[model samples]
Target: MEVKGKVVVVIGAGKSGMAAAQFLASHGSRVYLNDIKTRENLEERSLHNLEKMGITLLLGAHGDIAGLQPDLVIVSPGVPLTIPPVAEARERNIPVWSEMELASRFTKAPMVVVTGTNGKTTTTALIGQIMEDAGFKTFVGGNIGVPFISEAEQLQPQDVAILEASSFQLETTESFKPFISLILNITPDHIDWHGSLEGYIKAKAKIFARQDEKDWLILNGDDRETRALAGLAKAKVLFFSRKHILEEGICVENGYLVVKLEGKTVPVIKPEEIFIKGSHNLENALAAVGAGWLMGVSAESLERSLRTFPGVPHRLEPVLNIDGVRYINDSKGTNPDASIKALEAYPDPIILIAGGKSKGSDFTSFAEMIKDRVKALVLVGQAAGEIEEAVKKTGYYNYYRVETFKDAVYKARDLANQGDIVLLSPACASFDMFRSYEHRGEVFKELVHELAKND
Candidate 1:
């Protein structure tokens, strides 16, 4: 488990890969970094970090992964193990791992690990805030843009860290266990990376893979995928659900959010008290409350945080209300299920903006929900024609296909009338038109602002 001063070869010179290489080198390890691109094609800034650590670089695809004789192979989440060199390394019994796993082995701090197909960011951020409010020194990072090794050695057991774990990281980790593990829900996500729905679910289950019988493992009891796999957990089982009440967990009943713990009914807050206005977010709060319960945080603090937390952007973010038609940016709805949830949260007739890079998700089920709820559908990005076809297949004809987020927004605005909602809930990836879902959401917001100014 001791990775320090060992021979470490980090595959893929991406953000997490560079962070891992630099951190390993700083700990006296001779690091070897590799990337798919040639040296000249590499961005100068990333290479500079490795240079500062004095690590050796191997550019282009040709790598002696098996020849390095490295003690550990740090595989970036973006790198597939099926890559010939990496597979060859594994064949030689060279241990492979994620940066998160390698970084965690060096830390003694207690952690709150959060993983899901979605809501990982919001739930992790909420857990971090709750831990901080409980007077614990908190480190918030993992899959959410921060590497674990960067801060692991500096942490104490008194410190509480929240990690947003991804399936890619979970699949490679051997010792990436945590004191409190939260599996929000398992929906079909990252199928491209995981290769199948079953593979993805098994990856998410690894969040509890390393925990002991005493550790706290939180889950979503309502999700069939998560609930069906609960028996695989070694740790104590705790859950968040909307279906039924538990002696110890969070739930919704009679339109109220209740915390049932140790024969006590504690009301952290009601469903309506939550600032986040979607069904998925309500489930996210339940997961956060479950994390808080284990941290010994008072229900009062959980209630305050739930009501005060404004919510993360690109997940049903409301931009402006123009002429009684509210515009919502839900670019984070990168799957059919996620977009279906967003559509379900609305009561008013919706002028929906949907489409992006399809992840092999069937938008058919969502069309049923959209058909009844949507006033008009403005499609764009890679999946526009497919989504339009999907909507039509549902026997619903109110749809349009346009290019660009701005054009989509304008078309939605024109189609939207008083008391209607304009929603940018693309049920696909953003690679076709934007750098990311955040970029898509930002463009949606900017265009909404422009329209507001004109009105």
Candidate 2:
């Protein structure tokens, strides 16, 4: 772990790269940050900040990597292994690690890593809060908008790191084993980025790849893809289910969340006690309870955290209720299955705002869900036509296509009635209209607030 004079190269100048470069540079490692983006594309302030930290920059190209002769290379989650620089590093036999893998070497804290197609953020945040309520020092990060490397140096042996790892992050990781690894569910998502659905599953499976008998793998019992992974996991696998009563993991029984380990059963909390809506959110809470128990959190503390946690934004978040109409910003529903779950959360008539950059997802299931739940559909972004085609097949004609995001919001408001929910749960990525799902959700909240003020 000593990096006193070692030459290290950090790939991708995004958040993960910035934190990794800063960590290595501060630790006396000669750090080189290589990014595909030019200086003009990056923010001036961020560039100056990295320079102040004494990290050398290799921007706009990957040609300089061969000359660097790095002793080690750390890649950001977004940087794929297929990239030339990373492949070149592999060819040179230079030790390559993901930012999380490198961060794990610096901290002795036990990690609870959560990864799945959806519900990762909510589950990770819930587990972190559960640990905090149980009086444990916890650092929450990874794919939840904060890089683990940023807090790696400050961790103590008694602490725990709750990470919301993504498939992109897991693909680059080698030695990133967690004490408790949870896979909520797996469905077709990010196929465009991972090249294929099988490829995406392989990357997600990496989260528990290095785990052994001592560690725990909490998997979703109801999800077919997740259930199939039990055979591959080397660690002791536990299941969490929303449908059936689990014999050895976590599940809901007779309206209460319960843990059944060995021959004993302990109830955690009722589904109604959780502040978050939706059966899917309940499943997230179930997974968190499994992870919390593995981390030695008391049942009382787990129930307390479940009841108090208000849930994360961009995932079925209620912005404001105006004139009996609820505005929900589920902008994090970036895939067909996620949007389908969002639709199932409400029984009220819905004016659903959907469509964005398509990830090559099948819209048949999403359209079927909408046909029953959605009263009116407002479509925007690049995938409008594809979604429209899918909806038309269901004979749901109460749909409108908008050229702009703002127009879609206004149109949904105009089309909605009292007691109806205006849900912005796009079944596509936000890259076509915004920087990210968070950005898209923020914009939706602002627009809803503005509409409320006018009323």
TM-score of each: 0.94, 0.97
Weakest lDDT window of 10 consecutive positions for candidate 1: 60-69
Candidate 1 structure lDDT: 0.85
- Number of the top TM-score candidate: 2
Stretches of model 1 off by over 4 angstroms after superposition = 38-43, 253-256, 453-455
Screening candidate 1 with a backbone cut-off below 3 angstroms (N, C-alpha, C), the clashing residue pairs are none
The CA lDDT at 22 in model 2 is 87
Give lDDT per model, in order.
Answer: 0.85, 0.91
lDDT of 2 by residue, 350-430 (tens): 999999999989999999999988999999999999999999999989999999999999999999889999999999999
State the lDDT at 23 in candidate 2: 86
Model 2, backbone clash pairs (residues 3+ apart or across chains), number: 0
- The TM-score obtained by model 1 is 0.94
> Residue by residue across 195-229, what tens digits does model 1's lDDT show?
99999998888888889987989889888888887
